[model samples]
Target: MTIEVYAMLKDYFEKQFIIKEQITDINSLKEYLSEQKPEATGILRSCRFAVDDEFVSDTYQLKENDSISIIPPSSGG
Candidate 1:
């Protein structure tokens, strides 16, 4: 699976990365990210996920080569 991260998330993993797995569900991906970057766990857990431009839930399944993006919440003046 290939994932693209934005904003602060890029600091945890590369701005874009590839995972060697046939299927990577949203929840598993979140767990892996939090494990790898403990510092970003809270933020990652609250963030929204999109695969191929459509938002999906934690149970959503992802196939290899799928393009995923993580969008964390934001606050601005």
Candidate 2:
């Protein structure tokens, strides 16, 4: 699976990465990423996930060719 991170997440992790582990859903992905960087767990827990440009639920199934975007909270005026 192709993982793309944005905002604060990019500061902590690579902008993009590929994972071969059997990650079946967004929730699992979150856990995996958190384990990779324990310090980012708080942000990762609040991050939103998108698949192919569409926001997805935690249970959303993942596909090998799918691009997963981890979008951190943002603020604008």
Error of 1 at 32 (Å): 1.0
Give Cα-based local distance difference scores for all models: 0.88, 0.92
Identify the leading candidate in terms of TM-score.
2
| Clashing residue pairs, backbone N/CA/C < 3 A, model 1 | none
Candidate 2 lDDT over residue span 1-77, tens digit each: 99999988887899999999999899999989889999999999899999999999999999989999999999999
Each candidate structure's TM-score, on Cα atoms with residue i matched to residue i, is: 0.88, 0.95
Model 1 RMSD, rounded to 1 decimal: 1.4
What is the total number of backbone clashes in candidate 1?
0
lDDT of 1 at 24: 63
Q: Backbone collision count in every prediction?
A: 0, 0
